[model samples]
Target: MTTSSDQQHREAALTDTVLRSFESCTDPRLKLVLQSLVQHLHDFIRDVRLTEDEWRTAIDFLTEAGHITDDKRQEFILLSDVLGASMQTIAVNNEAFKDATESTVWGPFFVDGSPEIPLGGDMTLGAAGEPCWVEGSITDTDGNPVPDALVEVWEADENGRYDVQYRDGRTAARAHLRTGDDGGYRFWAVTPTPYPIPHDGPVGALLAAVGRSPMRAAHLHFLVRAAGYRELVTHIFVEGDELLADDAVFGVKASLVKQFERARGATPDGRELDGRSWSRVRFDIVLAPHGS
Candidate 1:
């Protein structure tokens, strides 16, 4: 025999019950955010009256996601990308200078302490798959060269696998190079090949249930940090990549696409012979002015 007043009080207790756990939070902003999140989540659950089976399915999916991750693969980040959450976060944080380089996905493959290497050195020393001479200049929007800018770059190997993915703990094909006097840097690596994201994880299961594919277009990832300029995290997308439109992470931007043209048969540019045909790519980075 539940009275009408008891039901009313119970309903009113919803907000109270949710806030009780957070009562010790001192930060007003954090408390506000947590409270709002609780309200929305509760409202959503009530609106849908989510079934126990559906909730169990979600838990199972997350569990599988955790099981698939080891040292190299980040199934959770892949999940965020496919669901557009990663892109949304990038968009929100990228509202600085309209004239500066656009920010792109940081991606999950970045490793700490890449081996320091000299300018114009080849990162692809062992196996030669494709010839690619990548040169880039970092500069301010007004066209002033940024010298000594630390340009950290990395990309998948010829087989579309990161060095860490196969090398375990040792430093593989990744390196960090500094810009020279001309504000230019160059490196030789394999021409990136499109590859599939790990499709055996929970994310892959979710995608399969909805009949989706897990693939990211071929691109080089860069993180540029200089003393006076805003730090930039972005990618240079190779033109004509098949996965541009259907990137699993939804990371493509019109501003980041660059052409990778086939180099002419043996010409002068101080480039030597590799059995594999070579490709040329030029990327110019526009950094934001210092303290803008």
Candidate 2:
């Protein structure tokens, strides 16, 4: 008869056999990573006393997540975000740049080849929302200006939907701009609004199972890059957003929050905005040097 002690011995033998199999791996990093992964996975399984039925269910859930992922949507990234894995990784990799701009998760909605606009140009493209003017400067950690930095910006409309969410997958409310010689850049965009992540897939089911809301805070996304400086991916969240404390992806940082004030006349540079009122925000970004 197979006793409990016999089962424990068998399990230990199986783990040792599996670990030995990785000893022949040629890549040192790969070998180390695989060994750690195996040990942790086995430990977790033992700690939970996971049953065969539960393992099968987990496999099914991952399979469904894979089936729903495609070019337009990334279920795996969504999985990482909802589980806080993405933010945790960012935190680990960005620990050295505490004084510089904090990084955040790059959501799945970013599209390549957005139209480039001039300084003080408008990115709204007649999108449906209140007009807002964003102005900022790019500088190094020591306060030296970085000229001609490429700034890519994208955000959802007032309705909390990206252009990709539409049936035709048309692009809107997104643009690429460059900092001027003085490291200053400005653009017009719609005010951001809180929105739910796409919740019709396996990730949604997981969130529901844990009784968590799927709403992200009101914010605008940015990707900035300059020569000799580290690439920065982050966002400026609107101050006092209702979901700021409970962002679905845990992306909010205190330094990234900025106030959006009401302005009823022309823009900051005195360019008449067709007599429409607008919101204004200034968010200066500082980048760390490469290898810092």
Candidate 3:
């Protein structure tokens, strides 16, 4: 009979051999990444003593995830989000700077070429939700204003559904606008409401298997860009939202949480609400310099 120690040695040798096979990779960074990935992945398999059946199941899960992903729904990103991998990657890349805004997961719902709105304009575009006034200023770590910054914002409707989810080719609740000379921006949007992530796919199944919920915290998305600063991708969570403590994607940061104050009177730009109650939030953001 083969000794247990010999089996362990053989496994270790196999991992070394795989690592050596990447020596021919011309790219230094790629070689390093591949080697590290192989090292960790092999160690995980050895530590868990993963069986063939379990490996097959994992492969099946990945296959299903790929099968369900499309332009509108990204199941792989959903899987990464549920597993906290997406947030981990974001954390690793978005290093902290002096009072700079923290970055978060870029959820799968972002659509490029979003329609542009003007300052103090409305982004709802007829999306169904309570009206909200979102105002903010963009500045650098030194407190200098960064004017003409491109700010992109989006959120789900009151029913926890994005416009893309409707599959009717409609664009609502999403827009981009430029900052003013004072680095200020204000737009009308809907009050964010907590909703479950797409739980009908493989990610959802994984969550169910592990006894987890797919609920994401109520929030609005923001992607900010300037000429020389690092791009900032983040969102603001409702202060009192119950899901904040257990956001599905692990995307919430204390600094990103803000109060959505209720308003019953005159609107910010003197727009008549006609007796409709609204909400308002102020989110001033600070950007880190590139390479900071």
The best candidate in terms of TM-score: 3
| Superposition error at 34 for model 2 (Å) | 1.7
Q: Candidate 1 has which clashing residue pairs, if any?
A: none
Question: What digit string (tens of lDDT, one per residue) describes model 2 on residues 68-178?
Answer: 988879999999999999999988887667579999999988889998899988886766898889998999988888999999999999999988788875778999999
Q: What Cα-based lDDT does every candidate model obtain?
A: 0.80, 0.90, 0.95
lDDT of 3 by residue, 82-157 (tens): 8899999998898998899999989999999999999998999999999999998999999999999999999999
Off by over 4 Å in 2: 1-5, 270-275
Task: Evaluate model 3: give its TM-score.
Answer: 0.98
Tens digits of lDDT, candidate 1, 1-292: 2348776567558867987889789998999899888888776755576689988998888888888877678878888888998889888876768569888887778887887888888766453357678898988888889889998888877777777777545455567889998899888767877877767668877888998887788888889988888888898888988789988788899889999988757723577675447888999998986666
Residue 242 displacement in candidate 3 (angstroms): 0.9
lDDT computed for candidate 1: 0.80
Residue 212 in model 3: lDDT: 94
Return the number of clashes found in candidate 2.
Answer: 0
For each candidate in turn, the TM-score is 0.88, 0.95, 0.98
Best by lDDT: 3
lDDT ranking, high to low: 3, 2, 1
Ordered from best to worst TM-score, the candidate numbers read 3, 2, 1
